[model samples]
Target: MFTNNFNNFILNTDSYKTSHWLQYPPNTEYVSSYIEARGGNNSFENVLFFGLQAYIKEYLSKPITQSDIDEAKTIFSAHGVPFNEAGWQRLIDKHQGYLPLRIQAVPEGMVIPTGQVLCQVVNTDPEFFWLTSYIETSLLRAIWYPSTVASLSYYCKQLIKAGLEKSADNLDSLPFKLHDFGARGVSSYESSALGGLAHLVNFLGTDTLSAIVAGNRWYGMSEEMSAFSIPAAEHSTMTAWGREYEADAYANMLSQFGEAGKTFAVVSDSYDLWKAIDNIWGGELKEQVKNTGGTLVIRPDSGDPIKVVREALQRLAAKFGTTLNTKGYKILPSYIRLIQGDGINPTSIQKILDAVTSAGFSTENITFGMGGGLLQQINRDTLGWAMKTSSARVDGYWRDVYKDPITSVSKRSKRGRLALVHHQGSYMTVREDELAEQNNILQDVFLNGELLIDDDLTTIRERTKH
Candidate 1:
């Protein structure tokens, strides 16, 4: 759940981090760090800034209690790592246990290009200089994972958008085109919640319910159905009915959830996919499917995605008939559609789209439910995400900090206090001391143990439109 820390900031970081208090420069009072996604792939240049507020609300909002310090001391003492008991005690006594940090960032869900700073942090109290970097382990993890997932989802949207524009009449169904089936595919419930919410930034349909809980608890979306899904059947539900009753199992699905305006999904590849689509769905249940007045999503769980989808669409159209849009692309009946939930990623999706297009069908005839490919296939280095110290103050003097490795110019970090601003129409990372005319887009999000900005999903969703 990622909340097993007992709300303890004292034990949240790496064990080696316990000794950092003794390692800092003498009279070190201030330390500054910034998080960025250095652009590697030209295609993934723009990224959605996300999940900092979740970390802030979940971890940083709570203070380190004396018991936390006591527990941390015991853990570190035996573990041979130095614990800052005095510093933690001072936090409880003087600051009421809140973190002395000033966090600034571009608004959540804004898709800014890479090589720009998305978030920056500095210790508010000089005494807690080590605190800024100490929070890096948690802070960077929060941003990188969700942000990377959101970016992958965003690029998927662009792919679907382009496909729809070329092969469909309108983009009316764009949001629900790519549905999330990644809840069980992730490593943890918290990862599912965080990654699921990330996918929601671009699309509206999902099977991941935990995303809605996170959206409400952290980003303040509607408590009810932050992401929507329809009644869907898995392999177990179909197989439990046995192979002989496969037709009956599908018929029961239609009887149960197939009302007017209510959509439902059923995995159709149980025994024989062609037999299920041809004999069962199109032949036997043809009249019922036409009369249900709701959309029936047929899922193909195995076989070559391109061949399965193209053949399934042709088979469905052979029985049910197809309507042509103004653009003249083949459109399936509103009551019927095809979904490919296996091995779905952008490359496979594009290949399947190419096959669909070649077969004279519109993209409207298809929906995609991506599981692990949508959520777990990415990592921190997927977009070159890093949080690095850019500035530090020692004995009343400030100096820019950075690393310039001769081996890799791309690994070089930024120097000086940073500000994210829009200069000449695009986002840019610049030095705060050197900038004068341009307005900094990075706003104070959290400061001195208090949240400075509270943004809901509605506001964040609107930002993605432009």
Candidate 2:
């Protein structure tokens, strides 16, 4: 079953509504018929989404086959959008066999750099030229959020590296463990899951249920840690409802699920964190954890994390009778780890890591949890992934017209389509928009009616790993 979080966004079989400046004319059969002719399966869901029903009405056909309906319905259901029986029939009638020119983008988790054409679409039929005008907005809607968040995760990895370098001394070892905990801040469940998957390229743990379901469905990773649920407040189960109880609960929880050679993180700022640690892990619980050989992760959710980490380490050393090397060097894997979560951004990470280095505790014992700085704070447009129309010509003149809000370029589009090629060792994004009349290395991805790019996410991820 699909998780409740992503169900609404993916299954939204509503009209392809957009927030762009361009719109197509009503019943413009030329475009609709063109899509229908070239293996385009149009449905009301697509039509409404495209928002071109009035323009494409002239090319409207009878109801599409159950197979087509089922395929779309399945896509929607998996995404968690409730089926809209009320408008299903109407959409089927309007978009049957009308495949809108769809661009098969690189899978969700692939880390694409700035200024790349994440995806693009055009009319399948020559007469349907007008349909291409509407693809930019929705395509970006699909591409931007995940790419941006993934990119943020990538940068965060750099901070982790920096922290490691600064604290090489006095630390045992540190694992690059990053977790996405920004679901509540995301605009929709779909975005949350996509963001989570994208982030996995750099950070593999997440706290969004939708991300777990969607990531496994698309990326073949169901067993991955997608969510971590432990409330900060104590409950009534003999564990009293306060900070002391919370700390004990954390140590006990880790002790209960003892996984040797693995790390289990506990939020330590539920009340007075040092007090909790002294009260719970200090006397007996700490020894139990040490004996079990499982590493404990103390998360600082409030206050100056760097200071907290220093004090926590000091207290641990005093209690355990093991002194921390104040200079540089690894402390060893058996020591506990520290994770910082509150208000962590790229800039803040540098600050905290620098502070921790000055105080002691090698960088190997620290990790970070990033949430808002990525999902809610960054603007997708700033990354600059756009699909522009470049022209190809029967004549020798080649032109590339790129649109910018501030200015228009003189390079006119050559007209036709675009395809990317692998030449030498680098990728050569070419314009099928016009054929060169010479043999080119790139293959036509969507030719006549079939899509040629391999749709598997794993294959793409592996191929681009260099």
Predicted candidate 2 versus true structure: per-residue lDDT over 1-466, tens digit per residue: 3233322321322334221112433333222111110101111111001111111121221223444445556665565645433233443454443433544343333433333333445455433344444434444445455655656666666567666656564222322446677878878776676666666555445666676665555544434453443222222432454544565576566656557766666666666777766766666576675775667766767887567766776676556644344554435346466677777787777777776566565666567777776667766343543445543221333344343344533222223345534446444445554436633333333432344442333433343244
Provide backbone clash counts, one per model.
Answer: 0, 38
Highest lDDT against the true fold, candidate: 1
Error of 2 at 114 (Å): 2.0
Candidate 1 lDDT tens digits, 11-105: 77888888888998899999999999996553687889889889888988887787788878787887898888999999889898888889999
Model 2 error, position 380 (Å): 2.3
What do the candidate models score in CA lDDT, each in turn? Answer: 0.90, 0.49
The reply for model 2, stretches above 4 Å from the true place, is 1-96, 100-113, 165-176, 220-240, 243-251, 259-262, 278-280, 317-328, 332-335, 385-387, 392-401, 404-464
List the candidate 1 regions with Cα displacement exceeding 4 Å: 1-5, 40-42, 222-224
